[model samples]
Target: MKRLSLAILGAAALSAGSAIAVQATAIEVTVVNDTAVLETRMPRALSDYGFFTDAAGQIPSANVTPYRLNTPLYTDSASKLRFAYVPKGKQAVADGEGLLKFPVGSALIKTFAYGEGEDRRLIETRVLLHRADGWLALPYKWNDEQTEAKLALVGARLDVDTPEHGTISYRVPNKNQCKQCHSIDDTVVPIGPKARNLSSDWMAAMVKAGHVDAMPQGTGALPVWEHRQEADLNDTARAYLDVNCAHCHQPQGKASNSGLDLRWEQDDPTSVGIRKRPVAAGRGSGGLNFSIVPGDSSRSIMVHRMGSDNPGVAMPELGKTTVDKDGVDVITRWIDAMPEKTF
Candidate 1:
């Protein structure tokens, strides 16, 4: 068995502007498998915090301040093997055997599958390393169970390292930075093709680390606050949608053509336009009315879109790869719970 380390390398680019020097860093990552435990260090830097909306559009800085990074990288028996969910504090680990990593964010990442074993493997994911603290794992799925054939991330830690600048820092990706890509909402609501596998062990460990609240009880839609409304969705729901939907449904987002802006604070059933009758045969099929056909949940186009996997339809348009039964249920309840429509 070969041991490997997964490192997210950040490249610092400097440019001289007039008399001042400007510096920018590009994220680079790599995953290797050899055998034996491996230790890898990623240079780190302290940066003033900035708000970045995730694919879902939620902001994470409010929850975890001071963006940080995890430096050392490696895999373990507990790491993600195939398409598994990424628990809060867990990351994927791998040995050189059947796993392969590619250079994407300037670093080599475990993206696709390889070798005959890969075809038989059920889960796939990229390993994320935290310097000493630990690591986590993530994966993608497209069914409704949200549990079967699913994967999970385990063992993430942050390590200390010295950069070329001689500054000591942890090369860990902060909760917010991780949210930037993995999360659908800024950092509040997590949505995407990838998900956090809510394994009992992983959840318990994260709670012990003080990184999360008690392990989530309900294994459905992202966490939502009590008393949230669509027009007045509570912070949690709004945040989740912002991350999950706004990425494509926003004004300039890819799915903007549908004209439904799912931003938490501004989700308007009216703006979604009269739900277009599902004429074309696709994922959003089987609907009698448009997205929310005034009081008719069964006929609503939005319901159909949320319940599909036909590729050509489905709400997020991409990434989901899995149908969130909990998410669907929440939406169904929300739609059904809406007061009898006047229209």
Candidate 2:
């Protein structure tokens, strides 16, 4: 393994109290290039790596304090566990809009696993490393013995079964596929770590720990979507769409030409695609007339795309190979409950 060292100095200027010359030594700190080494092979156990504080030796790394998104990407039946760690002396900052800006040397790890207990299968662990230049997305495929995972650039396709979704052709996206969703404005950024998607408790903790400067106040404090049974159908569905589709459907996203913005903050019904027709949808529209149809999910193109697993017509063009029935159901119910017209 090779190591690279980086030293950064604070730029705050020192001022003398009187009319006298002042001299000071610039603070210098070195950071070990852990991302370089971890990119090669996945550790036999999550604890083998120092990315998290684990005491129970859990497969998902117990002390990592798993975080959830209001809306999450659907990847068949594989459950995902995500963890993020910032380098010592560094912290993630928030953009003007409250989006988290992870510092260079930060790493976000997500593991996709299937089944449970002895029959459990660790599919792959994807890592997003923030370097001085930019972010790098790397995927590591787990071995059959469940001992280790190795870097896999080309990706893989496997026939796997999930108790809920049954057997399906699962595809592990290649490096290029990762950039397709992660890149916004031509720069790779995290899609799920936005303040709106985080729980309030988690956000407060991050602020108190100095991981982020501050969260937006008042209306800016977005609530995390709760389980369907506990939350309003409309809110749950909107949150789902925000996480799963808004990344590409927003005004500045790759699919912006479609005229649909699924972001949570968009309040205008027309802009959010309610009763709005698709733009240049072609076959992707499934012959539907509108993106959403008020009270009819059956007549909504968005619902059609969400329910379809066909490569040519799915809402998301990548990362998923099967229909997310629960997600579709939630959205459908929301549409079903909408009034035919809103003045």
Worst 10 residues of 1 by lDDT: 46-55
Off by over 4 Å in 1: 1-240, 272-287
lDDT for 250 (candidate 1): 60
- What TM-score quantifies how close candidate 1 is to the native fold? 0.37
| lDDT of the candidates, in the order given | 0.34, 0.69
> What C-alpha lDDT does candidate 2 achieve relative to the native structure?
0.69
lDDT of 1 by residue, 1-343 (tens): 1112211111122223421121111211211221101233321211111111110111121112111011001111112222112222433332121111111111112322212332222123233332233332233221222122122222122231222222222122333334344432222222221112133454445346544334454322333222234333233433445555665556655555566766544645566433544334354556355666654567777777767755677655543334545455555665655555543
Model 2: per-residue Cα lDDT over 111-216, one tens digit each: 7888776676778877787877788777777777665666677778878777777787878887777777888876777787877667667767777766666763
